[model samples]
Target: MSYYNGKRVLITGAGSGIGALMARELASRGAEVIVTARRIEAARKVSREIRKQGGRAIPMLLDVSDLDSIPAFRDRLHDKAGPVDILINNAGVVFGGEFEKVGLAEHLNTLQINTMGLVAMSHAFMDDLLQATRGHLVNICSASAFVALPYGSTYAASKWAVLGFSESLRLEMKERGVDNVAVTTVCPSYIDTGMFEGVRNPLFTPMLSPQKVVRSILRATKHGEALVQEPMIVRSLDLLKGALPRPVWDEVSLRTGVASSMKSWKGKH
Candidate 1:
């Protein structure tokens, strides 16, 4: 199915990393893509590349962390393209610091961009998406949402909030018979993105490729899958947590060196 063909899709954090890749991929597939980031130059560069590749896309300045900026963001999008058919909340952050070492401001910053920003953007576009009668809200979460490892308490908390928020939104949408408007949550382990440039993962699970993630997300959304976990193994881990007691799993995880490996990576990074 040419699911993305002619679809109006808006992607945040589209200046670089997975967001940039996703913008290119979707646009290549015929989607009318609108990408946003804090830096206008980066967004314009990516948009230019997409257009050069025979795709439809435009660059816009957006700082998801700033709620006040959303109206202007929406206005720009509205002027360029009416209501978006797909809203991809792919912007996020990860700060590697001890729970206590990470100050309140930094922690709040994490929440602002990784959590609240997503919520605000989605909410801002809700009226448009609803008017379209058929649209998708895809929230990019992380495997960290499942478990909090060393030095990632804050990051994990933000992601966990995303997971919870997505689930609740799903329920609310279903009850309202908003069948045409869907919500999808993507939870993947460490992606080979610069965000985790100095970070490490001990799970030994293969990191996800940006292109591969985009493929999965597109396929799953087209197939009507409510959630897409990039690596199937992550799903198994989720199940394992439920099967085993929390304390037992925690002890095993720590003894298995996953925690240590994470710390070691932090030290090196």
Candidate 2:
């Protein structure tokens, strides 16, 4: 028996990639998955497959970037999925390029969808988590949150923001003595999700498979872990960055291929 069994999990951007994979994985574990995406068809496709496989699933349309409509999205949830027991803020976008080459609008859109949208979802569904017998919040961040991603600045910034917010929320729950709901922030390296199509892998950090990352997420969420920083290198980020002086860290980043990893990035626009 898994902790996800019977849990009503809501996953954003579950049209494809890691989001869709997570939806399927959770549903197979006996979870009642709510697969949401901006494109209704995408959501329906995933839902249909889950149902075909004898898993519980509900497909819904959700544009997390449209902060105003999030309330309405939550309201609609009451009619179909009901109050969610697990909220996975997996929707995100990327405009990978040199700092100045990426348009201002693209950079801002990255933050809007990746950071603001995530915050809005967390706010809108928070009450449901509070009321659930066992609730969980999962935020799919990135290894860039801890290190530098030169060509993907906004993407990194958004993940960094998510990391901070997730940590704060987790601590706040602890302070409030709210043990029913737990927060888990997942930070994985460059995933082979086609999002980073042209990016070079950092030394010793091979591109991760979506399935592997999703499995780790489920395990961490089930165990109520605070964070999931993967690839072993990620686990040592804080120590490496914090212990080294500014100039020394800069040199280390460059020498380790982390700084140049995104120099040639051609991600999904």
Candidate 3:
């Protein structure tokens, strides 16, 4: 049997891209999937497709950025699906541009959805997760979290916060005797998802597919792995950043085009 068989998995931002893909992947693995997105119709479409494929799934409206929506979302979940055994914080937005070029609202909204929303959802679901005999929290961070990304500054910062928060929460959960729950943080290089549509992949670092990322996530969750850095190149770059001096690393990044990969970004506007 698949490790995910019979597990109840809740994925945020399942309307499209990585979130929707994760929902489909988990359902295919025999998990009962709850697909939530800000848009009700979008969520419903994904849920319906999963059901048509003989997988268990339900759609729900969950706007993580709205604090007022969470309590009601929680109540609805409790009334419908009980506690989820796995929570995938996969909903995020990316706005790629130089710091000064982007509006302040864009930066703040990035934090609100990518950082604050993740935090709020985790807090709202923590108790239900604790109630499970075994629970997993999967956070979708990015390779950008590992280093400074010039053009994608705000998005990178939000991911950095997520990486830090995921690690800290993992340790806290362990120390609190919540051994049954595991936290996994995933940091993958540029994914081919439309979110980064025109962004260039740095030299030797290709864009990953959503399927590849979802597979890595499931493997990590099943084995209780703490961190997942995909494509090997991402890991190598992270190591290089740690070993090299700051200026040297920056120069290397510049030469490799890592520092300016987003120069051509035409992300979801």
Please tell me which predicted candidate would have the highest lDDT against the true structure.
2
Pitting candidate 2 against candidate 3, the one with the higher lDDT is 2
Winning model by TM-score: 2
TM-score on alpha carbons, each prediction: 0.94, 0.98, 0.97
Model 1 reaches what TM-score against the true structure?
Answer: 0.94
> Please, what is the whole-model Cα lDDT of each candidate in the order they appear?
0.83, 0.92, 0.90
lDDT for 258 (candidate 1): 50
lDDT of 1: 0.83
What are the RMSDs of all candidates, in order?
2.0, 0.9, 1.1
lDDT of 1 at 5: 91
Better of 1 and 2 by lDDT: 2
lDDT of 1 by residue, 79-151 (tens): 8778899999998877776678768887789999999999999899988778875788999998778876677
Model 2 per-residue lDDT tens digits across residues 80-142: 658999999999889887889889999999999999999999999999999999889999888
Q: What is the alpha-carbon lDDT of model 2 when measured against the actual structure?
A: 0.92
